[model samples]
Target chain A: MKLLQQTILEKGTVLPNGVLKVNTFLNHQIDTGLMIEIGKEFAERFTDSNINKVITIESSGIAPSFFAAHTLDVPLIFARKKKSLTLKDNVYTSQVFSFTKQETSEITVAKEFLAENDRVLIIDDFLANGQAAQGLIDVVKQAGASVAGIGIVIEKTFQPGRQILEDKGYRVESLARVQSLQDGQITFLQEQISVTN
Target chain B: MKLLQQTILEKGTVLPNGVLKVNTFLNHQIDTGLMIEIGKEFAERFTDSNINKVITIESSGIAPSFFAAHTLDVPLIFARKKKSLTLKDNVYTSQVFSFTKQETSEITVAKEFLAENDRVLIIDDFLANGQAAQGLIDVVKQAGASVAGIGIVIEKTFQPGRQILEDKGYRVESLARVQSLQDGQITFLQEQISVTN
Candidate 1:
């Protein structure tokens, strides 16, 4: 978690959209060593959860979740945001609204892939408002599966996502929690912000 | 590679669109163990290429390439198919025509990720017509990075993808090369086909 925090401090940039961009090493262009360590952290945090599978949304979450799943020795399933031509099977779909895009899109997982008996751990790049995680939860519910916990690499705690998931009784663990990214300076939840008296 | 071939034999299905579907383990719902093995296999196969980074296109390519990058101890960069609101910098863009969409889409990678001194290994979920790989190659070219080789989990060799890439002087390696998927039976290149006999 400290390493992730340091990586954020070094490589992350605060965008005008009130978001933290970790494009340099988190998602777009990945730091493999950091990801592997992140995976180990996730596994350690959720070791008692009896997680049978890891689930995530496509594009950004795949890489990190893949490593986590590998470390846990479980399968990983990513919900597809857009259905492609080759994906013609019956799928469990849920609508997820993107605050960034300002539109809702249907996210899906093949109905047959997720079994009812499996316990899943949901992993993602960042948990902001938790819409994406909620969408994945909806899909898992449709398949009669149980979500053991939620593992996030970064959590924007200023948003209501963690509270929302916690209210629903899902065990949530995030390696790095951003308290604020205001005025081009990033702040984490557990770290003290310098207050000039 | 043998495990990949076995996975295809046991779980892969041939869709009516003449595509071999490995949605059960390869793409949609990933078998994390299989993927890790696939990663090691790719690393073993391309060990001598001196690949400093693994490059891929977003969505499906993320999982496999992530493992391969981890195994190779290199960074992984995935070219985003469309630019997002957060992506507002100088990027290396390439237009790729999608046969499914019947239109061209722009694929981009941030300029800073791919460096001129790097030797990249391009990894993809499937290689059918090489449009995706070509788009990535174009981005690497923009960065002045040299492509060591292209690694594919599966290749529909009947398509022009491998031919197109090979003609461009890129060494391509596929774990499972699908020769044909006629009559709902997936066939690989090594197995003697009755038609050829």
Candidate 2:
């Protein structure tokens, strides 16, 4: 988490409308070494949980989710945004609104892939408004699987993303949690976890 | 390669319209172990090449690319289909037509990611019409980088994908080349070097 926070401070760019671009490393042009580290961090955080599968959305989240899934030695199931012609008719779909794209799209997963006994750990690159995470949760519910936890690379904690998931009784752990971006500087919650909190 | 071939024979579903769906283990729901095998095979195939990076497009190609890139200990750079607001204005863009989706989509990579001296190996899930592969090649060309080789998981040799690349003098290698899918049976060109010849 400290390394990720440092990487964000060094490489992440602050865009207008509260958008932080880590495309140079995290999302677009990935550093496999850093990706492996991030995956290891996720594994460490969720080591206590029983995770059978790692679920994520298309595009950006796939890379980190892949490393996490590989590190955890679990299967990764990504929900495709665009409906492929070859997709089977029977699929569990959930409508998701992207605050970044400002469009509503449906994310789908094949029903046969997720079983009732599977415990899924959801991973994503960024969590702002938590729409994407919510959509993934919907797909997991439709499959009748258990939601083990949510692993996020970066979280905009000032927003309602984390609160909503926590309200639903989900364990949401982010590598870098941004408290705010006031005065053109990024703030992170780097406090060590207490022995009993 | 044998493991991959066996996987295809077992899990791959040939759709009515010639679209082979291997989502169970390849794309949608990924098997990390098999993908690691695939990565090992790709590394073995291109062991002699000077591949500094493994380049691929997003969504489907990320998993295999990750495995292959990690095996080779090289960085992986993927072209994003949609330009996020966080993306810079400077990029190498190319239009790719998807036969299955029946639409044309543009893929772009940040200009800073690739350099003239970089030797890139292109990787993708399927090589059907090869538009996606060509589009990736175009990006590499735009960056003034040398393409080391093109690696594909499955190649539909009957389609015009391989011929176009071969005609362009590109070294294209597919793990599983389908000579013909006749009577619901797949014929592989394991002993043959060039499917076109």
Candidate 3:
């Protein structure tokens, strides 16, 4: 978590409309070594949970999800933004509004991939408005899968995303929570939770 | 490579139009252990090349790219599918036509991540028409980076992807090249080159 926080401080950029650009290392381009460390951190945090699979959305969430899945020795499933021709007709889907893209898109996962017996963990790069995470949770519910927990790389704690998930009674863990990014200066929440009870 | 070929034969479903869906292990739902093996294989394949960075597109390519980067001890740079508010104005962009989606979209990489001095290896999930690889190659070229090679997990040799890259004089090494996928039977090319070589 410290490595991720340090990377964000060293490389993340702040833009207008509460957008944090981590393209240099987090999302667009990735530091694989650091990613493995981050994934190990998530696995350590959520090791006690009953997470059988790691779920994420397309584009940004793949790397961390891979790392976490590898660490936990579980399968990684991602909901695709654009449902390709290869997808089956029987799918659990939810429409999500992207504040960044300003467009509504459907995210889907095959019904066969998720089942009532499965425990799922949602993972993502950024947690801003929580719309994307909500969509993934909705898909899991549709498949009758249990929501074990949610893992995020960088979270805008100032936003309502944390509160929304907490309101739903889902345990959320983020590596680096940004307290404020006012005046182009980034701030972090220094509270660290011990993985063990 | 045997493991990958076996996965394709077992989980991969053949669609109507030469499309083989291996989302269960390769793309949508990933098998982490297999991916790690794939990463190790890629590392061994490109060990002799002076690859400074591993470049790929977002979403599907991120998992293998991360593993490959980790194994090879290089930075992984992925091209984002869209322009976000946080990305800088300076970018290397290219258009890729998705055969599965039947549409063309632009993929962009931040200019700073790639440089003239970098030697890149482009990695991807599938190489059908080679549009996605071409897009990534274009971005690398825009950055004046030398492309050491192109690595594909599964290449449909029946398609034009291999020919196109070969025409470009790019060293392409596909772990599993499908010679045919007729009547739900998957066939692999001669293992002499990839296996014995």
Candidate 4:
């Protein structure tokens, strides 16, 4: 967690209008070593959750989630944004609105992958408004499965995503919680008290 | 390699129209233990290539490529299919035609991540007609980087992907060289000689 928070401060770019660009290390150009550490952290955090599966949205969430699933010795499933030819029918679908792209896309998981008895751990790179995480949770619910926990790499605490999921009684664990990204400066939740003091 | 080939035979599904679905392990629902093996195999195969970076397309390609980059102790960069708000300008872009979706999408890699002196290894989930692979290669070339090699999880040997890449002089190492998916039987290239004899 220290490494992640440090890397975020060192390499992350704070864009206008509450956008944090971590593409240099977290999403686009990935730091595998950091991801391994992140995976270990998530696995350790949810060690007692009895998570049987790790689910995430495609594109960005696969790396950290895959490593977490690897460390936990579980299968990692990514919900697809678009229905491919191979992924036809028998799917649990949910709609996710992306504030970054300003679009809503259907995210789906094959029904064959999730079951009623499975305990799912949802992971993602960024938790802005929690639309993506909610979508994944919806898909898991459609299969009659239970969500054990939510693992987020970087969370925007100023956003309502964490509160929304917590209100629904999901245990949300985020590696780096950004309290504010104002004036091209990033303030983590933990650092907030000290900064204000 | 044996593990990957065995996985393909045991879990892979053959659908109509040259679609070999291994979503059970390779892409959708990922087996991380197997991916570790794949990373090790790819690292061993390209041990002498001096690869400084591992690159791939996003979504399906992230998992295997992440492990490969981890094993090789290099950074992994996934080209984005769509430009998000955070990823604006200063990018190297290429058009990729997806046979599965029957659509063309522009894949972009941030210019800062790639360098002119970088030696890259391109990894992908599947190499069917080599369109995706070609698109990745084009992006790397745009960065003025050299592709050290190409690693694929599965290769449709019956297709022209391998031949097209080989003709272009890129060293392609596919764990499972699928000879044919005819009659719903998954055949590897190594098994072809014996199957014919």
Model 4 steric clash pairs = none
Residue A47 lDDT (model 2): 83
TM-score winner between 2 and 3, please give it.
Answer: 3
Q: What share of the true interface contacts does candidate 3 keep?
A: 0.94
Q: Rate the local accuracy (lDDT) of all candidates.
A: 0.87, 0.87, 0.87, 0.90
Model 1, span A16-120: residue lDDT tens: 878788998977898878988988899888888899989999888887777688888888888888876767668889999989778898998888878999899
Task: Encode model 3's per-residue lDDT on B1-197: one tens digit a residue.
Answer: 89999888889888877688888887789898888888889989999998989998878888777778888888898888887666658988899999888888889888989999999999998998999999999999999889999999999888999899999999998889999989877898876655565
Deviation from native of the Cα of residue A84 in model 1, angstroms: 2.1
Docking quality level of the chain pair in candidate 1: medium
Writing each residue's lDDT as its tens digit, candidate 2 over B1-197 gives 78888888999877777677799999899987787788778887887898988899998888788868887888788899988766658899999999989999999999989999999999999998999999999999999998899999999888999999999989998888887776667777756456674
Better of 3 and 4 by lDDT: 4
Answer with 2 or 4, whichever has the higher TM-score: 4
Residue clash pairs of candidate 1: none
Q: What is the alpha-carbon lDDT of model 2 when measured against the actual structure? A: 0.87
Candidate 4 C-alpha lDDT tens digits along A32-121: 889889999999999999999999989788888877998899999999998888887889999999998899999989999999999999
DockQ of candidate 1 compared with the true complex: 0.68
lDDT of 1 by residue, B1-197 (tens): 78999999999988786767788887788887888788888999999999999998887787777778888998888889888777767789999887754678899898888889999999999888899889889889989999999999999888999999999999999999988888998888984557854
Instruction: Identify the candidate with maximal TM-score.
Output: 4
Candidate 1 accuracy as TM-score: 0.93
Highest-scoring model, lDDT: 4
